[model samples]
Target: MVAAMVKSARKPARRRLSPAEKARIEEIFHRFLSEEDDPRTELNYDSPYTLVVAVALSAQATDVSVNKATARLFEVAHTPQDMLALGEEGLIPYIASIGLYRTKAKNVIAAAKIIMEQHGGEVPLDRAALQALPGVGRKTASVVLNELRIEPAIAVDTHVFRVSHRLKLAFGKTPDQVEAELMAVVPEPYLVRAHHWLILHGRYTCVARRPKCDQCLIADLCPSRGTGARVPAVPEPERHRR
Candidate 1:
């Protein structure tokens, strides 16, 4: 017995950047684009359907962990039909290592059934359709669409949000606001891969605990750049490779 409130909450509109700020933002992405001509998601997937499931499972979980689990999971059930055949019980063991395996397993199973019964086993590319899936949400659908290059979207995960704020690219209190700000401010040409660039920057350079300002390509342009931050003393990549 609950009464609906007459007043509803509304999120503020995306931030508006001044001409100078806009130019700085453009320069920031220019550096990113030059460094990595084409950036892609770290999550491994063979097709759109696999990507949908991978993204769904990645909520509250790391991509590395998801990839490790999916390495074996996808071997047996890459398609919606295959996933349906696996059943929820059979699916649990493969993803048991993930953070919320039990609930994720159920959602995966339910999503599979919906995809098979409603969408003819093909993962729908439409935003509304994708979000309607059991495990799929706004951010997950955005990731799928953006990664596949079917849509230009900035899914404001933790990395993207933190990097956007750190770089002064966005001043948003929530993922939706940050996403809107990015969608509006980012140059159209780089919109598709901006999500990846921000994510990579945050994950490796502008890390949470202690950002490596020295390694950031756009440090000169970053308004939030920490002058006191020191370079991480981690070993160089491929330094000890055979």
Candidate 2:
């Protein structure tokens, strides 16, 4: 038991950024948005209910993977009533490909019941009401709200947390703290789409193991740009070829 406790207390290694590094990160984010189109989530959802369900299933999963599962799931059940009727047992096959399908399906069903019985079969627009639903947290609510074009909110996921720290956008140790810092600092215009931008950047370019730095538009503003980082480098053929 003691050995297990000691092992549990040992935290995984993580990267840290300095003040200069943080400044450079913000600069990169700003510069990237300056020339590019507004950012959006890759997950395809037609309504608020679909967006919330997609986000819930997205924990510790990929957007592409979630999208694949939801593509079929949404077809059969787009609303709370439809989802509740489908039931956890029935919903499993639709989303079974995802990481935690059983639990996600259970939560989705329960939340759907609540939405139908309590909220009159409509997705609530307020954060508090949204949070009261099963498996729905601030990050999930933020995603729904932002997608619905409501108030500006920052949803901190794995990509957001990794990218934010690496770029020094928000240095807090936890996702919640990082989210709060981002909300306080990021300009209003950028807040709603900021989560999407960061998630996409981290997903395709500033990746976890091997970021594609050479193709990154904001590499000039990154402190880790040329630190011999393990990130993937532009292929020699592609470099001059481009």
Candidate 3:
């Protein structure tokens, strides 16, 4: 019983991709670039302040839903001063359609006040400064940075996280670990738009419930193609041609 208990306590070995497999992953991203040259976030914002607020409000909310609210909200409150003027009570009505509008309203108002007083009414581009805001976290900060082109980062939202595990690009249990793994493997040139491509792919194609593997461009290279045997990675020349 003691030996059995000890054996049961041992963790299973993790799968590590080889150089060829890693290159194949890079090639998959290359294919994405070939298809969509300049991928971007779906959220619409006119300025850094609005973008920051939009991303913050987007937590537990859909971009479409957020955009709907922001379309009207931004018309009235595009700047930190404008948002501050709106106040928490005033802001709630604008974002009431969102999941946690009340809490989001409070955070947005507080963050806006901070930006106004501390950052001179501008959204700070730095990650540390952005995360210091009331509602902003690692993922939100990463999104703001990536969208603004202030930095190259992979923000592991549900879409990116699911796609990463589905493609066997990273076997991390958490978003932060998956992000580090991706940054290590993803080639330099493709880093800027990689997150956008992966997010779009997961949202539309590699869906959580039932991925459309048949229509997936990199289906041949995916280890989790839902088939038992591993499919061969498509050659670079052929991949670009498609």
Candidate number achieving the greatest TM-score relative to the actual structure: 1
Off by over 4 Å in 2: 1-27, 228-242
Q: Is candidate 1 or candidate 3 better by TM-score?
A: 1
lDDT of 1 at 188: 69
Sorted on lDDT, best first, the list reads: 1, 3, 2
Error of 1 at 151 (Å): 1.2
Estimate the TM-score of every prediction: 0.87, 0.80, 0.86
lDDT (Cα, 0-100) at 236 in candidate 1: 31
Residues 1-242 of candidate 2 have per-residue lDDT tens digits of: 32332232113233455676556656765776885657777778888889889988887577778999898889999999899889999999998898878998889999999998999999898889998999887677777777675756667676677677666566676666677777655544455567778877877788877778898888776666756443223323211000
Question: Which residue pairs of candidate 1 clash?
Answer: none
Q: What lDDT is obtained when candidate 2 is compared to the true structure? A: 0.72
Model 2 / residue 119 / CA error / Å: 0.7
Higher-TM-score candidate of 1 and 2 = 1
Top-lDDT candidate index: 1
Model 3, span 38-74: residue lDDT tens: 8888888989888988888888778999999999999
lDDT of each: 0.80, 0.72, 0.79
Compared with the true structure, model 1 gives a TM-score of 0.87
Off by over 4 Å in 1: 1-16, 227-242
Question: Tens-digit lDDT track for model 1 on 1-242?
Answer: 00111011112255667899879988988999999989999999989999999888888788899999999999999899999999999999999999889999999999999999999989999788998999788888878988887777777777787777777676667677777777767876788788899888878988878888888788889777875433222223201100
Query: What lDDT does candidate 2 reach at residue 140?
Result: 76
